[model samples]
Target: MTGRITFWFDFASTYSYLSVMRIGGLAAARGISVSWKPFLLGPVFAAQGWNTSPFNLFPAKGRYMWRDLERICAARGLSFCRPDSFPQNGLLAARLALAAAEEDRIAAFTQAVFQAQFGQGADIADERVLQGCLRVSGLAPGLVQRALDPAIKSALRAQTDEAIAMGIFGAPSFTSGAELFWGDDRLEQALDHAAAVTI
Candidate 1:
């Protein structure tokens, strides 16, 4: 049976990076159509009285998370680097993603940004880095100008608002109907739930 899933992610989330890289192939194998929804975690965290990532807020947690990420990346044969900044500003990237999603280039753009940030330890907030990502993704560089459009900015805000309305509080969340699954570990479970449902 065919199924549908909405993937909600934040550009700066480490675990989200893992899901972004693998979800596409895994979902395709299960006849599940995936929707890439990029949203900001700033507002969500603020709402919960967090000024930063829980990993950053709690040193013990932060240490554990980095080690966990290292293990996960090694096992998956993916590059891993701890960014100088824990959560880089993703405003520009989110706007660009919305534009890329429209042109059916979300996968390429998303992976490029993730790789740039996590794989190369580059700052994603830099316009030049983003431009490079656009180039590597086979998307026209002019899309960067489009990302500056007011409407695109508004669309990103709307997406974040929608995510909040859907009760999302974290990244790499999967929604199958009203069921919500959080984290990379839950990806397959979410897909299975989607597949089992007759939507």
Candidate 2:
């Protein structure tokens, strides 16, 4: 059996930005098929009695995260620009990613969205910005309308629920069968586990 990894991410997550940008190349090199799963972190945080990103709730952690992200991006040769908003509204983006999945363009669309938000410091909540991301991903800008479909909205909600059920509390998580790995730094370890188990 071919190795597989389920990638769980939230659009507003800074660390997810790193994994979304790098996973494609890494997975391909390892012959691992990636299942990109987009879900909301808001509900997950709410369940934990938090209303905002931990980075915001803890100022020192937020400061360290930004610097760490800068160093990692530099080392990886990836662009990194801290968004003006700590956690940009990603509800719309997550819905649109589900829409993209129907056409097998989710990965491209995801990378575009992350790049626009973290690379160019764009506001992902803006429809215009999302439309531009669609174009970058070689998808029609009209996908924005599809993202508004009731089915898509429900699907995103369900996906978030599933993430929580799977014990995922953060973005950039990976799952190989029953084994779950969290954080961007753990990506390689997750991939290695998947390759070893072929799950």
Candidate 3:
């Protein structure tokens, strides 16, 4: 009963950043295979009648999230800097990720983009940033071009729609069959459940 853990993540979410850099080693030890599924949270918010992040909609939660992000990053010995744009554009990043998905470069693509946005304060929507991330992964410059093809673009959109239908209201979601867990905090529990099923 070894289950593959589907890691549903969004680029703009602070908690997702935490999960991205840290989930790999832990899952490796637990014998959990991680499938990085990047999606856009913008449509998720749009469908809920919101135009911005919940953090921005509610200032108090937003403030606490920033502070929490700092402490979490510090504990992990990772740098933290909130991007100027509350919810940075993730469409390009997510599509690129899906493109990389074809080559098993999802992990590298995820790491580079996360670091670019959350680690170095770079803009994810910028073609330069997106290409830079890919170059580091040895992905060809035309990769984004190929990812932008009509077929691939539709697939990415369908992926996001599927995420919304799956009851995912937040980023860094994890799912195994009928079990769905949201947040980086639930990562370990999700792994435990995956392991117990096989045992």
Q: lDDT winner among the candidates?
A: 2
Please report, in order, the local distance difference test score of every candidate based on alpha carbons. 0.93, 0.94, 0.87
List model 3 lDDT by residue over 1-199, tens digit each: 4557889999788899999998888888888788888888888989999999999999999999999899989999988877888788888888888999899999988898999898888899899999999999878889988778787788878878989889999998988876889998899998888777653
TM-scores, in order shown?
0.97, 0.98, 0.95
Best by TM-score: 2
Q: Among all windows of ten consecutive residues in candidate 3, which has the lowest summed lDDT?
A: 190-199
- Rank the models by lDDT, top first: 2, 1, 3
Across 4-63, the per-residue lDDT of candidate 2 in tens digits comes to: 999999999999999999899999999999999999999999988999999999999999
lDDT of 1 by residue, 80-152 (tens): 9888998899989999999998899998899999999998899999999999999998899899889999999
C-alpha lDDT of candidate 1 relative to the true structure? 0.93
Q: Give the higher-TM-score candidate: 1 or 2.
A: 2
For model 2, the superposed segments whose C-alpha errors exceed 4 Å read none
